[model samples]
Target: MTIAYWCVLASCLLPLLAVGYAKFLSSDSDPKNYDNNNPRDYLAKLKGDGQRALWAEKNTLEAMPLFFAAVIIAHNTGADQATLDALAISFIGFRLLYIYLYISDKATLRSLSWFAGLACCVAMFIISA
Candidate 1:
């Protein structure tokens, strides 16, 4: 598979990773009362690191569709594979940094990282055109 395709796979996992991080850090919370079927409420009750992880998961989930669209759209439109691969790889790196920054409570840097990743998606579309 192409690097861009691999990036798509990696991007897909970020939210799951966040969910794990949130749940693990939230061990203190009573799982039985957590409204297991309603994760939003459960995550909302988390504090500190768990809260941070929850938000990171939310952010990653929000970014996933755009990244997927960028990769698929670029490929379908016959954009240069090498260029798309490079941009997609960059997007993955930025997303990783974004997750780390979010977990570390570095809001400004995380926002910047999110912007960079979004830029990558935007560039992919521009390149395809």
Candidate 2:
């Protein structure tokens, strides 16, 4: 399979993995406790779900265009297999690291990971261009 294809697959799979991890992290309390009527309870649940969703949304917003741009540039400029693979893997790996750091609430580490992923995306586009 092509590098772009793999990147797309990874993009789709990452959010699902994040959701699963979030569910795993949730407390083993009664479902009634998740009710939307109570402001505090609802806010708590929203906070937890929002973190994961925000991370996924940010990743998706940043990654998709880069992935597509890489693919298009690769096709246009005849980029080599290794270069394409490296770009794809870098994007995926950095995104995973970003998710981990975000979930762990490591402020500095999360910021670093986010910056690294953004840099990787820019670098990929620059290289492809």
Candidate 3:
């Protein structure tokens, strides 16, 4: 499989990382605080960085479909493989940075990272055209 395809896989899994951090590692390690029986409820109660991580997971999930389609469209349209891979990697990088910025409460940087990731997605479509 191409690097772009691997990136698609990565994008699909990226939200899991955010959710894992939000649910398990963000803070409040007391096991009783976690409501496995009602995970959504537990997540809904998260605050500060935990809440930010959950939001990051949600936003990442929201972005995945378009990025997936963009990569596939670029690949099938005979866009340059190397360039496609680069953009895919860039998207991942920007998203990782976005997650970090979100968790760190750096709203401005997070927004910039989000825009950069979106730009990468748009570039994929442009390359396909």
Most lDDT-accurate candidate: 3
TM-score of each: 0.86, 0.70, 0.95
lDDT of 3 by residue, 36-125 (tens): 888998888888888999999999999999999999999899999999999999999999999999989999999999999999999999
List model 2 lDDT by residue over 1-129, tens digit each: 777667868876777666545444433323445554663454345455445545655565666676667666765776666776776778788778877776666768877877776776666567666
Best by TM-score, which number? Answer: 3
List the pairs of residues colliding in candidate 2. Answer: none
Q: Give the CA lDDT, 0 to 100, for residue 88 in model 2.
A: 72
Better candidate by lDDT, 1 or 3: 3
The reply for model 1, stretches above 4 Å from the true place, is 26-42
What are the lDDT figures for the candidates, one per model?
0.88, 0.64, 0.93
Q: List the residue pairs that clash in candidate 3.
A: none
